[model samples]
Target chain A: MDPQKTGFDYSTFNPSYFQHLEQRIKDLDALGIQADLILFHPYDSWGFARMGQAMDKHYIQYIVARLASYKNIWWSLANEYDLMAQLGQKPLSAWDFIGKTVHQEDPSGHLLSIHNFYDPPVHKGTTKNWFDYTKPWITHLSIQSDNVFFVPKWLDDFQKPIIFDECRYEGNIEFGWGDNSAKGMVDSFYRIVLRGGYATHGETYIDKPNTTRPIWWAHGGILRGESQKRITYLKQLLATNGFNYVNPMAVQGPHWELAVGESPDKQHVFAYIGDNQPEFEIFDFLPKDNIYSAQVIDTWNMTSTKLNERIDKNHYFHIPRKPYQAILLTKIN
Target chain B: MDPQKTGFDYSTFNPSYFQHLEQRIKDLDALGIQADLILFHPYDSWGFARMGQAMDKHYIQYIVARLASYKNIWWSLANEYDLMAQLGQKPLSAWDFIGKTVHQEDPSGHLLSIHNFYDPPVHKGTTKNWFDYTKPWITHLSIQSDNVFFVPKWLDDFQKPIIFDECRYEGNIEFGWGDNSAKGMVDSFYRIVLRGGYATHGETYIDKPNTTRPIWWAHGGILRGESQKRITYLKQLLATNGFNYVNPMAVQGPHWELAVGESPDKQHVFAYIGDNQPEFEIFDFLPKDNIYSAQVIDTWNMTSTKLNERIDKNHYFHIPRKPYQAILLTKIN
Candidate 1:
């Protein structure tokens, strides 16, 4: 009942408010952002088919479904729905209904998937029934794990490729922020890929409403906006030329010791990781040994660009680190 | 308004309810663990401290302070206050006020903490802050790690030994209710302590609200009411003889190939952290290999349990383990 509190509020409605949605869609059309990931939270929208009393919440839910019907929108039923539901919390049902409504509304094709905090169970004999195949359905998860649970648990069974909505929790070279915890990220990347899968190592963030929190935006400092570091790093990396996603099979590994990103042709690329010994985990996942160039991106400055020159399996890297740093390697065809 | 449908109803309040508070305190003490965490919606009890009701909803605060006045009842304040404030969805005043008022009420020693979906920041300077030892406080966190924030960050630095107020996020393991997910609890116990700090790894049940989860009651399915395996294992290895904690400094160089526990008198009591080659980092931390006995109890379990059969470290240990479990070793003082 307390609007400023953290549970579901009954007022974020007003379906007639769709009056502005048309213009908002047109505005997004000009931005060229490609797609809007609309994470649907119906219960939060105050719309419940079960709630027969208030027409306001119901109307608001309708407007939400209608707006998401516009082009350039990908519908993630709800952000981390599995986690929420498992915790015995209620979310909006409008997601499944929204997907159906979006198709009936526009029909050009609307992407649908549940934005889960981890690999959602591909229900018994219902993997296909769970998501829209028009676009990839990715579940957000952490790549900062010692074991590669994403691929086997979710991706391997999916008909469409699964993108790791959130593979890394912290990324960046700044202090205060979690930029200092990259070791786990670098390790998890290869572990996921080498086991055969795709994941987006994106960071997530939250901010306050009116005032501002340093790391996040709001005074309460909860998740609200886009995670800055991973987004920036991703957009830049994807923009680079001659770089492509690597293959899991390409790496010769008994147990992948590195994270590698190779070209589509497997001709030009590089893989590496960081550990106590300036050594990288690359060889653990690679098949070929006749190496190209080897470099160590100082964790302190990932943008500096340096190389360890030629290296082999017999050697342990000599680069010494005081902690809170990493080693990056680059290679070309 | 719709209590059955699950939202808290607020229209039922009567101001005269507070005049009889002395009895509420008596009841709480008598019916302690029998009750759920008293849900403190401060705005519900006391209204109009009036910081512009326009900005927040902190009315039920008096109730919390009043309840804390009684001994033996544990409680969680408004579920997720941060998210509520953001949507203009809830009363900001409750949080704003409770943040200040709870201290005034619980000054005589009571457990306190917020149940954030993820880990929230510890208020920097508090008279009864978790770090300052002003009081024994707990952070309400989970085990499955929903899309919220990370849990380890809070557990590692939390001052009063931490407790996983809600550890059921991992209820469904490996996509099913019983797919070897129980291993997760074990792995989590190791991960929490080895990587960071102490955790009272208990869980909640829709079936048994009053009873502790299996981990706490069963001890990895061993005892009927406690986790003997967990406690005994940790005590022997990490909290050697209860005099001191196992330290990270015991590991000599990079390999982190070893881990150790020593007596306050500077004698090695345990060391088994390495690969097949046995890179015990405790070499330097050991006290001149003084005569001692290394007793490997249940060495068959990969999580082998061994003990320092004596009071010194002059002995060598050859611990054989089962296929998949943790191996524990102890040096006799």
Candidate 2:
């Protein structure tokens, strides 16, 4: 926190210090990584101390309004937080303010929200009370392993388009650390899209993930651009799929499966088995005409392959269970 | 990242001392996270090298042998690797090692798998020929999000326990730090369980989390913890009541009506609407015996009323549209 901006050692960064933040926002404008709630100032103890109840609410109002001035940045919100409440914390209250102030300036509200996790939403109905239907709702990127893809259910009921407020990449290589240490990067992506929802990642070291050490960037993999390259494809593929068609349904066979996108109706059927060398078939109950042929969309290279005849209803073509591959069988049309 | 045992070096914890090479893995026992990985012996480079194979059936042999010693660490097998023909990165191979080496050590092979978002298993049934069906499986985890609880679908597939393998928890308050950071810790719990699985998180710091940020635990509110408290609770609840109970069918109604919890039997039902002010009797549905008594598990402490609801098909209860709370209506026991 560059505390000089707010004057108390300025934990606030003026529109000055890093041209990167502004440029990145512009690039996001170009790439459409636009959602709301981008945090510039992290936990500023000084700012928090001086502002008190007025501290963040006033600062967030300043931050969001300033960012709102530029179309490049649409999300205007703060931590509106509550993860650690012991510090006389008041992020959520500020969110109440954000909910009120943001819409007053931008009707569509620029897809904004605050960041939170470890803690579920304390202020749920506030957004609906303040912003109109067009305004997006804010929510955290649920990170617990058991909470895999839990946000969709939260958002489904939230009655608003949720921007995954904060999703961190973490990996702990036993021996404690080093190479292959961070997690929450690509794996978190799998959880996000199971229900055809969207979420964002807060890269630990934004500009250069490598600048960090054994744990942050870890291994020479960063040199290989391992995390970056894979995530780009995932983001594009999920975004391209158009969430509507990817509804959640239970698909069980010799093994467990969760699938999105129905076979014929949506012009395609996509099935994903989360784990196991699930021995099963492609078409167990086909209505004949709905079968257009099965193709495995290998996400790694975006590889597309058409299957031969073993994939029929009676045969139960063996699906050599692999992780997160999108199998789509188009309508014969 | 163990600054003490990381085997790496830092320029007094500043940018100039960014660590590039690891010291050495003299004894495999001291290899994990105990010793620093950056303190490369200025006089020697290859002194600290992990045994990874680009060339033989015994490829993962060395590391496997070490882990077989039964250390108490969650291990992941390969890093984010894909066999790409177009990029001349094809001729890829890895299965033999994981099957023989990793599997032998951890019967629950998922503890080790590739870290990826879009990448599928290239090692599944390849010619190096090391995969079999104790479960022919692949593990998936999305280290994509900044949210600690959010996991990608790739890791959600484990019909059994699955480690998030790679998650990022820097405890950096770039957004609003502190307890807000706990959201990642809390969300990470439910995210994995709802997917019918168990999970893990990755943290980044110079020392053991407990040692450094003694309070920064990855629990209901921090980046460090003895166990994922809330995550365990949520997962236990879902597992106890079939995961399918939380399926999301559709949102139909005047308020924000939506359904979640999915099971093959479709016996369990969860529904929520955002009209907290609605005036409907709890059991407006007559002949409540026809349907299961709805039990709303206060997973997120949203309610403390207790599980005491009598039911009938005519149940018309007023519920608020919220997150982390689910209502289960099952056939009466």
Candidate 2: where are CA atoms >4 Å away? A1-24, A27-42, A48-50, A53-58, A91-94, A119-146, A162-187, A202-225, A235-245, A251-255, A262-265, A282-289, A300-302, A309-315, A321-324, B1-333
lDDT of 1: 0.38
Model 2, CA-based lDDT: 0.39
Best by TM-score: 2
lDDT of candidate 1 over A215-309, digit per residue (tens) = 33112234332333433443344336244544443232122223345556544344433232222222433335645555444433334355555
Each candidate's TM vs. the true structure? 0.38, 0.40
Q: Per-residue lDDT of A1-333 in model 2, one digit per residue for the tens?
A: 223445563335556644555675676678755634444223555445335444545555666655665575655444424442334444334455555555565544555554442321212212222223233353223221223443445446554544443443322221101112122244445545555445544332222222245433323224332456656775565455443535543322211233344422455555543321233343553445444567765544556677664333344454433544556565654
Model 1's CAPRI class is incorrect
